[model samples]
Target chain A: MSKQIKGREIHLKSRPQGEPTPGNFELVEVTVPEPAEGQLLVRNLFMSVDPYMRGRMNDVKSYVPPFKLGEALDGGAVGQVVRSRAPGFQEGDFVTSSGGWREYHVADARQYMKVDPNVGSLSAYLGVLGMPGMTAYVGLLDLGKPVAGETVFVSGAAGAVGGLVGQIAKIQGCRVVGSAGSPEKVKHLREDLGFDDAFNYKDGPVADALARTCPEGIDVYFDNVGGEHLEASIGKMKNYGRIVLCGAISQYNATAPTPGPRNLTLAVGKRLTLQGFIVSDQRHQHRRPDFLRDVGGWLREKKVKEVETVVEGLDKAPEAFIGLLRGHNTGKMVVKLASGPA
Target chain B: MSKQIKGREIHLKSRPQGEPTPGNFELVEVTVPEPAEGQLLVRNLFMSVDPYMRGRMNDVKSYVPPFKLGEALDGGAVGQVVRSRAPGFQEGDFVTSSGGWREYHVADARQYMKVDPNVGSLSAYLGVLGMPGMTAYVGLLDLGKPVAGETVFVSGAAGAVGGLVGQIAKIQGCRVVGSAGSPEKVKHLREDLGFDDAFNYKDGPVADALARTCPEGIDVYFDNVGGEHLEASIGKMKNYGRIVLCGAISQYNATAPTPGPRNLTLAVGKRLTLQGFIVSDQRHQHRRPDFLRDVGGWLREKKVKEVETVVEGLDKAPEAFIGLLRGHNTGKMVVKLASGPA
Candidate 1:
């Protein structure tokens, strides 16, 4: 109880009007509180920056509460337990919690889930074997329901979830095509991720690229970037196609309301099925074991690879997040809060 | 094979640019050929005009093929077998077939299904007991999946398919709300069709009207008129809601593509599902018996009432179809070709 330590944490300085800036976040020094009864004190090693956080910056009511101004912004983080006043937890135990954007946190031990350090790198828990990974796994398998021999198309294919989505579709014996913002991302999709075809949507019309790449028509679409990408996917969908509404990163930073795809009416004639979902929904809890088993097996077999862009310090979290919105990251964007046990 | 009779049939003179005009259809007199072996010569008593027909009028690839220029348009019609060379069909037998917009047709008997006149009126086979009725049955129950006590909202509630959707939801023990084009249609929805609430969409903003009517938010939305109605329904949907995409009568005649609901992105956070379908899909064929049993029993018990707007004469079929797109008909809109046996 006498031992005291200082730690740095990132707080929401002000809500962004549209596209977030570095000034919207502030780094401040704070005391790392001692673990209370039934609680544990954790020293965070890594914190994740995701596209969905932009929606919480707004004051509107959503599935999750908005980030309060001048308060610490929270998300996925992985850390090691430094002190524990709770049962079933010991010093040096690695765990993941929704206490990100900080170097350390003290909370009830139940709030954290222990992770296997031997399975993946500590940062991998925040990306590949974590929220983003589960999103890709469940969204594609449970919702998209891509069958073998069917053509599956994904947008933002170089990102963490999209990259895994393409690989998983290939594993299911499907023809996979992907679209990304840059030629480098497209090349990575084809050569590294083994997508059947990849295209840089910025070079030409998305519809033309889809037409040339997916001549057989898309049976499933993993939508990471909405707007133009969604419109083109709908136009090219085969009859009874499934569109997984995973993320709409392209429209998150728009100052004004973004227009939806104009050809959406084609869903009727084509009998397409479009579904949107949240990973944390109670209905998805039962599928977690399946996700862990399948994705975990893939990692061990080297069938799915983990890709990440890491920033050095918690102070640079705002920069990392802003860059994430700008599509600067090749995969998952995470900030390294502290060095874990060597 | 020598007996001949004069009959009038409608032909697609040209493709309409936007809204269809009377000039696009040409009524021409033709000789009715005698029935060949395994064929039946039928005299049509009634013909159906549905919103889906508008899509076929365009020279585009859809679920059904586009009508060829100078060829007689075909759709659902109820008729009596005037002469038969087929073993299954007999003279004076009533049947329904895809040989509409004509006074007489000679086709293989396999193309037609015999109808029991005691179940409903001859024109009801073209409306309530026919294709439109089945569209409502399968779309709402199979796709929408509205559970009892859930709130179901339907657009184009006065039209053929939409009207049946509302009543079916009521029979499922759901709180049904509906939107129509006119005051009379709205009143009919609330009073005669037993909808929980009804609104005239032309009287005010659809969003405001939906907010007022569906205070608890919608669990299922049966979409017939797309455009504004679709957008409003999406905005008012509760979490995990199902949207049945039946028709987009609002945009069927648009010269340019219509934009989808901007709030469609909310589907991700709310976990909504949207599915579109055609009634003739092979997958739905197995559900015909269930539809006939439930809807037929409802008709017999007077739990679901049959309502129709009839246009006289085969020459008026094009006008009836054009009026259907303009929201000029309440319930089902059908054209009477001739009188049935007294």
Candidate 2:
């Protein structure tokens, strides 16, 4: 006797022109493929929705390839291996893979890494202790190079990477200020994340807010929102300042390419260094051990806090991702699958 | 009884609104001041009129203080000491100081550096072995970091720094391209300076010209003219490309800020680095010895050629400055006061 298992997955229904909508995503059911030799079948537990994924949705040449129409989307996912035909991977083992937005996927064992549930929450693996965490670690410490007593400014403060950036700057013994979309996120940054100051960018002009919050001027700017945020950062930067170009969520949905900061010439007189980077760079793999050791220690010591906004069910993943672009989430936004090995 | 010698100097009659005019400058004569303790009286022979001086005309706070209204502007000048009341300097000694747009001026000995006239031509100190030379050396070597076999794109390539930048990159075994304003200047860059390729920006579209010249994409961009040139360079940069923000002649005259490069977000995907710098930074004081040794050797060996556009008489200094803005000169633009000590 033979049995077949049906699994659900989300596909890109259409390319978005401006802002993405529900119609852009389609949820479909398919027969789960049996694990072949050196492969494992994973039942997804949680999938991540990130700002960078917005770029992937567009058909453009970038560091990573664009998503094809009618194809299942791929991203960070924590899953449980239900069937395995590979060495070092077995049934009931929890692992992290790039088979996100799907209920079940057949992945080669080499493509997924086993996750130790004893470290932190499984959802945290898709967020604070995962890609977003590594981004904040490398962007702030490695690039920004915040020194003790230096003033640090972070845009998109309440989002995944920005939240950790502020906390890490604080840990580096620096003065940290942050800007977020909402008052609640601003409060979360100041009170929960231990930022020195926080402002709701929706309330006033970014330059005015930065000027008011950081009187001495920013020595390091961790740019996440870009556009006006980048302009404001340049206007407020001190001499020899460093700008870590992490992400530009503000212009992600633009149908046309947005203009850069008009005050970029200020970089000349101020002798500023603006460096753009991606987490997938080889330096990341080289520095991951140090990040795991230091940030892991900070997490265990309660010096840093983790936050996640979870959406239940695979059908809600599209809504979760769309809401993420709208700044609806307080921290890392993850979609929780209905069933797993547990 | 002693007759006082009159000193002729050019003063800023009015701050320019956009493009400078002859009316903005006033030539006046004043009695030459005597050299006090630790001071020297110099009879100017040659003075440099550079693009960066335009930024000083505006009443804005920058790395260097703005030029005061109705005052003789100061820049790199080579002069012979007519009289000296300070140690380590004597009459007829050729020296360099920030005393420009004047026939005669008084300077503190500490503000002047004694130049060995035997090392190179007296004007050579103002071009090849001076600020322009050091600017080319430091900006290309330290900031731009053109590795051997990399492609370097230089804007305003026939100008003081750009010409030298291309030659130095060639010395480093790089494929170098340049963009100048006129066909004559383009010919100078390719024919005289030995750049691998060059284009006349005024001929057609900068993007098209860059695409034609930089087939493999620009690995290092020495930005001298900003706005369109900077935009085109950004569009053609290779992954991990470096931009040395040296000068921005294109925007220095604008009454309003122009739009920046529209495709700055490409930096994120390409992992590009754009750094702005000023030659006056302390790093120069430290690296000056190395610059002098290497560039001086190159100059002595005739491996590099020096060119200067001499606008005779102090009265033509304003014309020289305005012509410089219009990209009239083939190389370093200098105003000749008269023959030096020789």
The all-Cα superposition gives candidate 2 an RMSD in Å to the true structure of 1.5
Q: Which candidate is the best by lDDT?
A: 1
**Where in model 1 is the C-alpha error above 4 Å?**
none
Q: Write one digit per residue (lDDT tens) for candidate 2, span B1-342.
A: 134768899998888999999998999998888888899898999998998888888888989998888888889899999888999999998999999888887978999899987767888888978999999999999999999999999998999899999999999999999999888888888889999999999899899999999988999999998898988899999999999988888998989878888888888888899999989888677999998899888889987888889999999999999999999888789989989642
How much does each candidate deviate at the interface, measured as C-alpha RMSD after superposition?
0.7, 0.8
A67-102 in candidate 2: lDDT tens per residue? 999989999999998888999988899999999989
Which lDDT value does model 1 have at B92?
90
TM-score winner among the candidates?
1
The per-model DockQ list reads: 0.89, 0.84
CA lDDT, every model vs. true structure: 0.91, 0.90
Worst 10 residues of 1 chain A by lDDT: A333-342
On a 0 to 100 scale, what is the lDDT of residue B124 in model 2? Answer: 81
Cα displacement (Å) at residue A174, model 2:
1.1
